[model samples]
Target chain A: MKKLINDADDYVDEMLDGMVAAHPDAVRRLPETKVLVRSDAPVEGTVGVVSGGGSGHEPTHAGYLGEGMLDGAAAGEVFTSPTGDELAEMVRACDGGEGVLCVVKNYEGDVMNFDTAAEMAEIQGDVAVEQVVVNDDVAVEDSTYTSGRRGVCGTILVHKCAGAKAAEGADLDEVKRVAEKTIENVATMGTALTSCVTPAKGEPTFDLGEDELELGIGIHGEPGVERTGMLSADEVADRLTAAVLDDLEPSGEVATVVNGMGGTPLSELYIVQRRLSELLDEEGLDVAEAMVGDYMTSLDMRGCSITVLDLDDELRELLGRPAHTPALTV
Target chain B: MKKLINDADDYVDEMLDGMVAAHPDAVRRLPETKVLVRSDAPVEGTVGVVSGGGSGHEPTHAGYLGEGMLDGAAAGEVFTSPTGDELAEMVRACDGGEGVLCVVKNYEGDVMNFDTAAEMAEIQGDVAVEQVVVNDDVAVEDSTYTSGRRGVCGTILVHKCAGAKAAEGADLDEVKRVAEKTIENVATMGTALTSCVTPAKGEPTFDLGEDELELGIGIHGEPGVERTGMLSADEVADRLTAAVLDDLEPSGEVATVVNGMGGTPLSELYIVQRRLSELLDEEGLDVAEAMVGDYMTSLDMRGCSITVLDLDDELRELLGRPAHTPALTV
Candidate 1:
């Protein structure tokens, strides 16, 4: 039950307050709503890109808000989906008049909630809204949170790629096309060394033996493919990489994002990166870009995930586009 | 004692290899030396600013290697100092014909090692090497790692400020002065909810009781002021802020970095920032800039630190200058 929080109910709000205090120039909160909008939202003629999901996953949606990234994010409670009303607020706030694109994770709650927001936007008129549901996790489909494959760190790539397209003045349909392309090309799989604690739960969401680990772990501390005896760092990387590459065979030049679930150190992430690079080299897939850090995280979950974005020329150009947000800038 | 590492001895090398692989465009490994240099080092006229210590503090010395950051960083063994030979190699590799300034943390091993490197650089006769030892941690004057206050996260600010000055074409002496000024103005204090593990040491560096914490903990997982029962998050923030602010007596406006000790989640850090912003407001100090995340970390320690830099116009301008490194970009 050890956590640095005031109360379970106010955790998301207070966290957002702290975020606003830290980056007032970058993001702002909609009054009384758990939606964070880029301060420069509705940029004249550019399509709006909005993404969001549960809280706890730091820097996922909101942390990707900025010039070449998401225009806004509707935040849910820790591991819970955002409400439909908040999604509607986020959509309206981010709409730049050309159109708005919602990048939803594959979780059922998120898909349902954002669909409601899109319906509301269509009902209200004036602005068009499009939605793309990312289901990149090769680890699980039909999890506790979703009816299909759970979206994981690859969603960050979707935000970056789609947001880059949106910033290029692409309409809602174009942005949605690029986003769906990303969803089709990216695959992710993770392994957890330890469980995480959501504020509401105030305890470890799951438990394992001292020398055990869960492979193909989901971000919300859900059960993974299996709990097995701990493997060496290289073995773990090989397993995760095999799972992801099997799902999406990346060739030519690919972009890799080795993401750390909260609580893992950067050194370990680099170790994972080392093994991944060797594997990619052996497979003859040139790595165009490799991002190794905490882009998406379960709240203090000690683990790591490898996301490989099978890159063609357009995807490479979009991923390389310059962007600035609180946690990510590339 | 679960950690994602192979052979303990290969940890630093593999980690550095991974870093280079992930950021080949940004950093490179000098052959046979435990040094990572900017890919475009020895810029011919700009002063070379180099910093280093033990290896586990990621994004510390190496992460700051880029356009407006350190020209190079010497990597030592895990939680151990780099050899004088490695530091010397770093200075020579970064020299650029103008001069090189070594930014050393205030630790006995680091100080002695860099002192040796400075002597060697002076004797070998080409690069005029000047050094500024950062001793900004206000917790204790002498502790496990040094005869002076152990440099903690505040050292990152020194790299940032000095690196900016160096990038602006400041001479070696001028960059050293700004670095020293950063040391004079910045103060930091940290608390540990859990100790860290060095790859060299196969187990936790220190032990803490359940619901217990240690205030004023050092970066090396050394003992802190005393072990005490866990307090509310706000209470923890109040004490850490008081310690740093009392040491600094910062007025007007201040820049802050609430750094995670690697294992704490961003939500917890935001909670700490929530209370810290309140404290600064009450004390009549405007926060000019606030960075909340893991910048410098001890392996996988679960804790946090607050660094407050009292800024004047020049320091503020220098700190705000654009810089691009692996972990930090501003």
Candidate 2:
């Protein structure tokens, strides 16, 4: 394909350089590091939030690096985790008077790398570091008894809640508490209508017939929980939301987010949510806040996911706070 | 290919129905009309902002219905325009004590339908209505003695700037003025690496080889002005920006938006903007603001677009104002 890249291998670095150059008002590159931070980062006493994962999920980590989202983000190759050193540099660059909070997604490589980086940050900067592993996707089972579930679209909620808490002048521990609370309250379930093509691979991650879908595929195109026949909008919504509600049912009023997995139309997402509402209404659940769009996405998979968070007063207020980021806002 | 849609024809209507059911806090359906409006719309004396287009570009007009973006939106079939009656109902539902402004993309059906609705609103109610046609894409050209230019990604800027002005209590004429000013100052050019498949069509709009790109493609999978060999990032940026600069070069400062047409990764978009920065620097131009993301997408087409808007003081301030829409923020 005709791509605007110098070399496929150097695409991430070249793009990062341009990001710093073009959005000087928003982001700046950390000196001698692959990390991009808010232009006025390292705020004095507030807990610093850092997040990173694959590179292709644009505006996820990097685009969220602004006033009320992430402090710094270390980007890796497409669908690959950053090395320990890269993650360490990002933590060191974001550390201020308070400690740093690493919002690591529950991916094997990402978990291992961020854990190593947290140790490195303690050794290098004498900064207190804590990590919140987001495991929102209800599709995956415990890979191993030692490892937990995989994180998916629910990471965006973690970013928002943590950002709001940090913006409220919360300390590192408080920020971590809010993040963990949000994570516990949130649950997500995703399905893919079509496989996405990885640029390097030059083909879809897997083959899917025109009449089939991959239910609960991973962001990296990992096998879904199951492949099922096509469904009505209501059925799809029921399947996805049933999985989510089984994990954490919203009590009283709750916050809801319907995420599009890259290639699905917004219209379809609404249909999914429509079914979701009917299902929720049947269970007598009330929606306090709702957002539906593309927040976290697989490259070009055509599907949608649902996330519901049972909100208390604090999380509700935090969720309602104003946030200025590239991809999200309150 | 395995979509959760009931039928091809009912897809858009079902999705709209679902949107209203799910986001009761954010959207409401005009009973009998099926248009979507903010739940708290028609604020007294505030100009109403209404926009809509085809279905595939999720969150373009629909997701943007919020505090400072659009008051209402009329969704059509996938890659098709909503009928005139639908547009008229949207206008009525959003009309407040003052007036209503329709931000119509420069497509034949959209412009015609919205214009018809404006006429209907004038005769039916005390509401004042005006229309602003956005023709910002430089990809399409106006033939001699003819006015036919396609609106592309830059329409988001129009919605944002105009929505801000309307939120400030601008009347119909003033809102029209601000929208027109943005349209005149903005210019855009797009190129596609791969064609997207319309759900109903079940096939790509067009085909491209492994190394080919279609430059200047329309938002609705229309043929581009030219098809050329693949180019490097610098070359792609040069070619795209050259058209934009040729159309309207900002004097001192400009607001630049590098938008992906759905499937292009941010990694590639950054490289495109890197070259754009070098070219703008060579021209001694300053960028007042810049943004990059998938704004107005064509299904899952893999490509990016460049938009440059010459900014004056008033336009710059409006652009800088907070816009709390689903797709964008302050």
Highest-scoring model, lDDT: 1
lDDT of 2 by residue, A1-330 (tens): 345677778777887888886788778987766689988888777889999987766657787887778999988888888889989988887877798999998988899999999999899879899999999888877642116778887888898889889987899889999999999999988888877766677678888887777777767777687887776767777888888898886778788888777666666677777778778878898887777777777766677788888889988888888877656655
Give candidate 2 regions above 4 Å deviation.
A1-4, A144-146, B2-4, B142-147
Task: Tell me the lDDT of model 2 at A318.
Answer: 88
Across A1-330, the per-residue lDDT of candidate 1 in tens digits comes to 667777778898888988988888999999989999999887879899999999989977788889898999889988889998888888888887888999888888899989998898878756688888888899876787778899999999999999899888888788889999999999999999989888887788889789999998888888798898988889999999999999898779899999989999999999999999999999999999999988889999999999999999999999999998998887
Q: Would you give me the overall lDDT of model 1?
A: 0.89
Question: Which residue runs does candidate 1 get wrong by more than 4 Å?
Answer: none
Q: Tell me the lDDT of model 2 at A76.
A: 87
Q: Is the docking of candidate 1 incorrect, acceptable, medium or high quality?
A: medium
lDDT of 1 at A80: 87
* Residue lDDT tens for model 1, B1-330: 788888888999999999999998999999998899999987788999998999888878798899888899999988789999889988998988889999888899999999999899878856799988888889898998789888889888898889899898888889888999999999999998888988776788888887998999988889798688987778889999999999999989899999999888988898889899999999999887899998889999998999999999988998889999989888
> lDDT per residue, candidate 2, B1-330, as tens digits?
445577778777777777777667777888766578988987777999999988877667776888778999888887888888889888888898778989988888888888888888888865688888888888767622117878888888898889999999888889889999999999999898888877798788888888888888877777688888887777778889999999896788888988877766666777788888888889998888878777888876778889998999998999999876656667
For candidate 1, what is the TM-score? 0.98
CA lDDT of B253 in candidate 1? 84
What is candidate 1's TM-score for chain B alone? Answer: 0.98
Candidate that scores best on TM-score: 1
